[model samples]
Target: MVEGAWLWLTLFAIGSTTILTRGSFVLGGEGARLPPALQRALRYAPAAALSALIMPDLLLDAGAFDPANPKLVAGIVVALAAVRSRNPWLPFFAGMGVLLVLRKGLGW
Candidate 1:
């Protein structure tokens, strides 16, 4: 485990980096405008980030591709539900319901 001066130095470096990056936009003010292409691309960042975080869990089981994985099945179900339903909550709940039923109720 990290200890002593090295740990404190590491934490300070991390904290400083976070503050500088996050504060850059605010400090730059109205003149600091992103390019139009960049602005458009940023719109997909949230979805990309979400998929980056979730796709692995859904597609991989025990570090191998598993077509029969319950999470994979639930993810497909949720994607369909999101496309069909206008209500956001419906997909969220549907995904959770399918996951729970598969993982717990049906013992997948």
Candidate 2:
């Protein structure tokens, strides 16, 4: 675990880097455009980030994929809910509800 001055220094460095990187566009003033390559790459950032965050939970169970995993079923429910309803919170609630039902009620 991080401790003492090292932790403070690490936190300060992270905060400084985040502010500088994210705020660069605003600080560069209006009408400033990113390079074409970066603009193209930025378009896929959300999908890539989301997959990076969620793919592991959907695919992994005790270090291996398990067909019987409740998370997999809940993820499917969430995916279908996401496609069927455009409302942002619907998929989250649906996924959680399905998970609860499967894990608690059905004992999946």
Whole-model Cα lDDT of every candidate shown, in order = 0.90, 0.91
Per-model TM values vs. the true structure: 0.63, 0.72
Q: What shift in Å separates residue 65 of candidate 1 from its native position after superposition?
A: 1.8
Per-residue lDDT tens digits for candidate 2, residues 37-106, read 9989999998999999888888888889766789989999998998999999999999999999989999
Q: What is the RMSD of candidate 2?
A: 3.4
What ranges in model 2 sit over 4 Å off?
1-18, 29-33
Error of 1 at 88 (Å): 2.8
**Candidate 1, 41-80: lDDT as tens digits:** 9899989999899988988899898778889888998999
Candidate 1 ranges beyond 4 A from true positions: 1-23
Candidate 2 to truth, TM? 0.72
